[model samples]
Target: MAHQSTHETVDARRIEVIAPNFKRRLSGVTTTIVQLVPAQRADGLEIAALGPGLPRHLPKLRYRDLWRLRRPPQARAQRVWHARRNTEMVGGLVLRDVLRMPLKLVFTSASQRHHQPFSRWLISRMDYVVSTSRKTAGYLERPSTVILHGIDLARFRPPGEKFAAKRAVGLDPNRKIVGCFGRVRRQKGTDLFVSALVEPLRANPDWIAIVAGRTTEKHTGYAAELRARIEGEGLSDRILFVGEHTDIERWYQALDLFIAPQRWEGFGLTPLEAMASGVPVIATNVGAFPELIIEGKTGIVLPDLEPSTMQEAASRLMKDDGMRAAMSSAALAHVAAHFSVAREVAELRAVYDAVSPPAETRAGNAP
Candidate 1:
């Protein structure tokens, strides 16, 4: 896709919303901004993203575009500056308070842990705050609207046949495949997932597991250790580690079961993504997994990080074909009803409307 030039004739007056992601790395915050920007625009809101690492196709405001905030965007009393990170929040505060720009600062808190003094101060300055889950909201000192992360349902729906999806991904169609996807690290509990599946995978000849994701430089030793353990058990063929894939949705579609064994997380979305792809998840009780997973309905949630705990849950779910099928249907329905991207966009728009100027003055001044 061709990128919009920095000098392109984008009407600054039309930009009612500015979503800033200063971080270069593609974290969950970056992912949220990338998904929501287009959806917000589709809802007739003139939203644009600002910062590095975002896709070229999305509407963006260049660094030089900061000047535009001095004059309120057309059809809005003040442009909403949406920040997802502490640095982004600082940037927004600088624009609004330091530069005296006519901007409304909005920060979305995703971390479930207690904030430091610096973070608390930054968050307190926001005109409005959004929390990704109820658990996340508990950490906030101020009032925050809980808005759970939603997935692009159209992009992550079920494949016609699970085996066909496996074949397309170059896997044996006959064997039942389970997957553990995300950053391969100790914190993500990649080791926990592997350890738990070992006994069950060794026992069941028809079943195999795949670990799909990248292990960064810091976690190279940890990834090698996990691989070494798998090799030592002579289960290399049964357990495979395929590196990150650009088209992760297709991989999710191929899985008979998905595991998210994170030791900790801040509103992790892997379980939601798995459910959206019509796969039942077996996730650890971290982040918002307890709330996202409907226990026996959508998938099983482990109370602790024990390999035995996960093994028992996985074995039961895997053996019961009828129950797995029921969970699959329930998973899809649950995501569609509660976690659609459209719903997230609507909820966020309502928050923006609440902080923005009235319709009369906003519309009356628009050229």
Candidate 2:
């Protein structure tokens, strides 16, 4: 019932997880809801091919279920058949087999891109299509649904003391902290964050920054380049690299501000989490940032994602305690109202009921 549920539960409703990375925040929260559907009931499988060795807490669906359900096969025939078969299977199992059962199909991000053909095919058949961002939802012409991923306020709640996080993370608590957490990749705009944000904040001795997450992939070299830039700018002492850590919320609490200078994002879950933790967020105005943030109210959004503009916004937030406090309070209130798990789940369930065939009272003969 709690959207922040960590344990596994099952039921009769057929809920599928089409997200590729089950361990990621969106997939994790989506799966948490799927778990509550009741037992012996085969809901939809969340097909995230994010490789093996997932977290133990994540439930395991049959391999066939995952492989069969994943969007748009490279082969044309296979993709069509897959969607059709999925539709028929869900329709039969939920509508014909169990009269009162419900069926819900959800997918996110790049998965929508990969499976567009299959997605369009399944759209008319699906009870609900959940898009993580309105931009993503716009890609779908059909009547669809949206649930920007919800953060677990229970875990990501504001820390009792902000300084404790800085101390715990080996940062100087005396310095004003501006931090970014999440995978360091081109799409995430790590380069932009450093150039746009970190460089501008360099003028203030009180401002320090930490970029945390694995920088060892193809992006490792890029990370190296960023480090080199920091050194070149004489900011070695100011910027710290805190690689990947399991306890990320601790990192959230450590910061005076949270910065996400991404080029584009899909309903960025982190900002919501940061807001829930009562940290003021300064993010690029791309994807769902406009939807999640209330400009100067909940958080500040960069009008132009350029480095100069970004740096200016970051500098403004860093310098103004009154504005930061107002934004922080507003951020928490915004999350509680719009991004709360209960609100999202309730909306999703309504979609499920509306789309469920038996639940549909539209008379076939009605004019």
Candidate 3:
């Protein structure tokens, strides 16, 4: 009964935009929706999220509310259904074709690889498509507007004092900190980061490294093995696996350097997040890392997944305080100019405007 009331309330709210997240787990796509929905709303777009596992603070559409898409809401423009995942794309097709919802389906593709036939068919049905990067756009059979992801600058700004930030997070304030954050698994290059930092961290007593983020149930053994390696090297104190953090921006603020050693990625955002927090990064040339990092300015970009490559880059950055400081400044400036959430939202608004129905059509269908 309570759920039914909530559905009616959401239905009557006249959501002009619907961002769907069919996946329950908080993935990169889910994170994007959570961050961008509010920013879109702040820009005077009546955007609401639909699906499970989203936070309650954001406006949400219940399953029943999908029915409203069939008839234009009284005071609203035509609805834009933004989909990121394959499942959401499929659902949007059913609503738009089978039920004949007055929805403009827009899909944002982040994957850089070739798609299967099933996925390609879904892509063919989108009214418009957006790619998160140029590389992502290359994978699409149809032309797509390239719009890179952006970080919320306000939430990810640098702390006034790095040492104080470290101390606030129960880390050693005196040590120079480097961080590798994300899921702890082989594909994410957790072992690569651990191996690269082990020797460098051991040699430099003043330096400490952090491996933040959790290992899934399947990857528990991998995490344990990495821990054992750190313990065996007698660098457990210096190389810490502090696990997953809720306040990840604080961790980025506390770092002098950040490393993204992923072997492969669809589109990694940690490098941008680290840069936004005024820290330089060392990232492998995978996904959009090469495009995001300004080599010799914001951070170094390595060509391979070799641990020695990351080690060399990290060693160089660590040894030169002046270079690190310059890179940190450049990193912050680069992000502010090119990667803020405001920029992403504005670009997305343009896409929505281009694809959404005309005011007259919307008004004509109004209840």
Candidate 4:
């Protein structure tokens, strides 16, 4: 049973850890699994993802492998099960408690608010807990290890030529491009970004703004309202709403500045991504913004989400060429030093190693 394998699957006996993406939709949790699982595998950990929605190439176990969870991998007496969501935590609980599977349950919490009683109880049962930021950790009743998210630096490095990168993305090379990317809804503060930029774009002839993200059907009215507001300002051409983009890294490369205008977040990654692309940011004081952004050095993390504050900050940066350039350089260095994928991978290794069996104990056995 331990050695049973499915189509395009890794041998089940070899997997010492399982990362399950219980959800079918590609949410932030799925993105984390996609990005980190490969990095973990390359770090020499025998980890496989379980469930649907992951890329076919990722080493994984199908849903039918639920029964296969009955056996521990060949080398280890117990395998680690890392869960990021409530359904996943419940799945692990049923596997280990109900079915008596040999798994050590681990959960990673990224929520910045208080958890419901049931969620808190679910967390209490984990073998180890991880928080994405100190702010998130504050909301957790149990102690947790703080591990900030990191991006693929090779995929998000600075563009060689700013204007050329802008031109490549079909943007006007003459005007400075400022961007805000995420869901087009009130929750993401897309309206705040637009309101923040309207006054600046109206005053400055040299700057342009772009909002790149999908507006779901639920928020179609919100998107239309924002478009109507932009149309009212007679800045429709200057302020563009480009729909969802697959080549997001390229869009990031073309920006002179980035904005993360979220009023609330679990642990925001857009600001990190913007900084990784060597673009200075104006981010709200939410999620891990304060942790990721070095105020006045790399970027400004505003105390509030007011459009006025964002406008003034962006305007101030736009006018000062030297400050923008210095911030750009500092952003690149700060991310490289503090938030590389390598660092994230290394930190996660400690979490895995803490709960997993020692190598000497699980080395020689096989199915």
lDDT tens digits, residues 1-367, model 3?
Answer: 3454332235534777889999998898888998998898888777888888887777788887566677865444557889998999998888888888778899999998999999999999999999988899999999999998898999898999887999999988998999999999998999999989977886677899999998899999999999998899898888888889889998898999999999989889999999999999999998899889999999999988889989988888888899999999999999999999999999998898788854656667789
Q: Score residue 166 of candidate 3 by CA lDDT.
A: 91
Order by TM-score, highest first: 1, 4, 3, 2
Q: Against the true structure, whose TM-score is highest?
A: 1
Cα lDDT tens digits, model 4, 92-175, are 999999999989999999998899999999999999999999999999999999999999999999998988999998999888
Whole-model alpha-carbon lDDT for candidate 3: 0.88
Better of 2 and 3 by TM-score: 3
True-vs-predicted CA distance for residue 123, candidate 3, Å? 0.3
lDDT of 4: 0.90
**Candidate 1 lDDT, tens digit per residue, 13-114?**
789999988988989888888889999888888888888888777788878867867998767778999999999999998999899999999999889899
What local distance difference test score does each model get? 0.90, 0.62, 0.88, 0.90
lDDT of 1: 0.90
Candidate 1: count of backbone clashes, pairs at least 3 residues apart or interchain: 0
Kindly state the number of residue pairs that clash in model 3.
Answer: 0
| Weakest lDDT window of 10 consecutive positions for candidate 2 | 75-84
- Score candidate 1 by TM-score against the native: 0.95
